[model samples]
Target: MHADADIPTEIQRTLTEFLDVQEQRLAELGPELAEQVQAARDATSGGKRLRPSFCYWGFRAAGGDPERPILTAAASLEMLHVSALVHDDVMDSSDTRRGAPAAHKRFEALQRARSEASGSGGDPVSFGIGAAILLGDLCLIWADEMLHTSGFDAAALARASKFFDAVRVEVTAGQYLDLVAQASGTSDLDLALRVLRYKAATYTVERPLHIGAALGGADQHLIDALSAYGLPLGEAFQLRDDLLGVFGDPAVTGKPAGDDLREGKRTVLVAHAVDHASPAQLAEFERLFGRAELDDDEIQLLREILQDSRSVQACEDLISERTAEAMEALDRSPVQDETSRKALADLAIAATSRHL
Candidate 1:
């Protein structure tokens, strides 16, 4: 591990400049719409800004200008990400995000204030969740509108629109697979990898690069090469995320310790543990897995079991292997620009190696 800030200072500066324009554009709406947009903007605070940075560099790597439309598109993608977080927090019933109150929780507080003024008998949590859902929908629509309204010609707009559509479908499918895996208790490694590809790989890395490259008129060969690099990196990133969910410090991660354990996520770590646990250990796991009443002691025991079984080491090894694969893909790709290739490689390393 390395931090993203340590990778490339100039790219970070370019990303900040792009965010300024995006913030201005987000503000240039009707008063009520502006308020909604502002709420969405507020939700974006303290993120890694990884997606937008990916989109920006993807564009630059493909020789696209970081001008108005490109910036707008990148910002719009960020807004879409914010929208996803809002809904995800609601679904996960998560109270905190990025070291602050979740958006739905923020809205619930607003709902409580409004109810107090009106003496209304309404559930603030439900109201807040409903409102956040609607807001997310609005952001998704606005993201499309922003992309469409960018000064690109009809042909370019169509291509970009197609890319966005594919991204949306793939991400949705990934989410569905995640929910299904959680519900069905299926921990097959192959199934887990499939979910990883849809949920993290394509949307997080591959499609972002493809969308930017397509907008920049990149040919199919370059797009394929980028996908080859992005897919493994994205998988490695998700696997790292899964590890953090179980083992990371709550203070740094801004999430509950053992939250994934409580949620019973069928991540690769869990799958490995299940495969390796002895009958006695499996009995303990069966008793504790997905139980809402599991206590800190139980969680600690489960963690110890995972450690004793070497599941953690297995995940670490997998991450290293995937990183090597990603680097190989990047090295073998036909990307001509040394700077862009190095930046992308550095980002892949940073993304997978992040601790929080």
Candidate 2:
């Protein structure tokens, strides 16, 4: 459970170099688009670049060079992630992200300022949302372009492209399931776990590792082994994120406390709480969940109930189990490189560790 700040020196060096290259590439799009890219890049700052690190090490594990195509692909994956976050903030109506004003909100404020100066007679919020959406789309397009132009061999390109496409489809399907679960009040734990696999696990860890491996010319056996390790590690990562959404310190997580409660996300933790809640607790949750007007006191009470009901403990136990499975999978992997294996193991620890 070491802090992400305590990442191994080589991994940290690789990430810093990767980010520098990304920044330089971002600057190549000219001043106007570069500002947009910079804004998007700002969204990524001040958090664990866990996914890219996974991809980088995955490449190393498969005997891939981290300097060119592999690192470029990892950067593109991060851009895709940034695009998703921008849209997610808009869809969730979140006012803050990364301890700052959400992109859409920031754009809205800028739009209003411009509109007021020019006496424009249009909806500023709508204008801002539209701008943000286009910005996200631009980032997505750039992500694809980054990967496409990396100049890998035909076979490697084909494999990586297939992985990328599958990742996109799975994430979208997971998002659909999430929306459906929210609208229908289904919240089945199995269904939630499925969403976790598609939405977070595969895209975040498994496919990234596979893509890196495929680009590096790894065989099917190695790819399958990485998937085994990645799946549980990815789930553990998201589960920890869900916990942070509710219980994390705002200063550390860069979001308001009880944000998941406010958004009414049907995370595994929430699902467990609902399943184990007493009648009175259920009533209280029914009254409070998804209410825009819920006060801090209500949020605090819900937190207490979640802790009291032992759902948090259950979630912690699940995280521990998943992390252990990830380690076991890694141990069984045929990746013989000592540095790569240690990096992967360290990544697994960093992914699920509570210290962030």
Candidate 3:
């Protein structure tokens, strides 16, 4: 979703400063440690800044001051997002992310170069995975340090941290659920939605909003209202992502076509197709859907089957419905800031309307 694209210029500046400080501090350790920090900086550098934007707007909607500490607090979400993506690539065994070789792939290639230079006898692939895993963990730890040192008072930081802690735990648990779904090949639509709720929605929107609202000293009523707006919008966000994973151009989306299918993702789109397809189409889907050998032709065949079963339109309808619901929730929210509320409305459209 790279570089705070849609909103909040200040948030991006704060994030960059925070990372610079992190790099300088890490440099005290050793050059190798600095290299790893550089990897983290590289990984963290660009993104749509979806989480930070949501948090910022949420803080604004609750009438929180446009201040540095809160912005720093919001920027922490970027590191959290980096952690998620790095680990997710490793878990999915994905080849690329945002048009670059994935973190693990980047490290694997580094291992290869070092091996060639030193004539080492280690396994590059394993070394890459190990390094990437540690990098992801470091990103998580860095996010915590950023939050703790964001210059908020203890009471305010604690308030935001409640949501922050819960968000990390929820998303990680959701990740495990998603991995389980992939391994078991569970195609049940309800289970898929559950996984979506835990894995993507909370991290993407809901908790970001909650964290911001908490910092803004929102009442429970306001928090609940924001959750109402965030969750449905968050679902629409992930559903759009699923559609893009299958249908988006590699040139723009930065991953190969059919990458999700290659990973055997049990998306609601695929689950809906499973429910509605004809026997012949189902047969074809099962044959090629999760196979490692899926070629372009097979991928096309799968796309066609999904279309024939009307899953594409069904998913679109869900996105439209959820978007409307999120807007309605925003309308009902007790937020007094008309400008920020309007921005949130625009953000809802941006989240669901883009082809990226």
TM-score rank order: 3, 2, 1
Q: Write the per-residue lDDT of candidate 1 for residues 66-101, one digit (tens) a residue.
A: 553665666556666776777777777777777777
Give the alpha-carbon lDDT of every model.
0.76, 0.79, 0.87
Q: What is candidate 3's TM-score against the reference? A: 0.96
- Estimate, for each residue in 108-147, the C-alpha lDDT of model 3 and write its tens digit: 9998999999988589999899999999999899889878
Worst 10 residues of 2 by lDDT: 1-10
Candidate 1 vs candidate 2, lDDT winner:
2
How would the candidate models be sorted by lDDT, starting from the highest? 3, 2, 1
Top-TM-score candidate index: 3
- Candidate 1 stretches with Cα past 4 Å from truth are 1-35
What lDDT does model 2 reach?
A: 0.79
State model 1's lDDT. Answer: 0.76
* True-structure Cα RMSD, model 2: 4.0
* TM-scores for all predictions: 0.88, 0.90, 0.96
TM-score of 2: 0.90
Candidate 1 vs candidate 2, TM-score winner: 2
- C-alpha positional error of residue 170 in candidate 3 after TM-score superposition, expressed in Å: 0.8
- Which residue pairs in candidate 1 collide? none
Candidate 3, lDDT over the whole model: 0.87
User: After superposing candidate 2, which stretches have Cα over 4 Å from the reference?
Assistant: 1-35
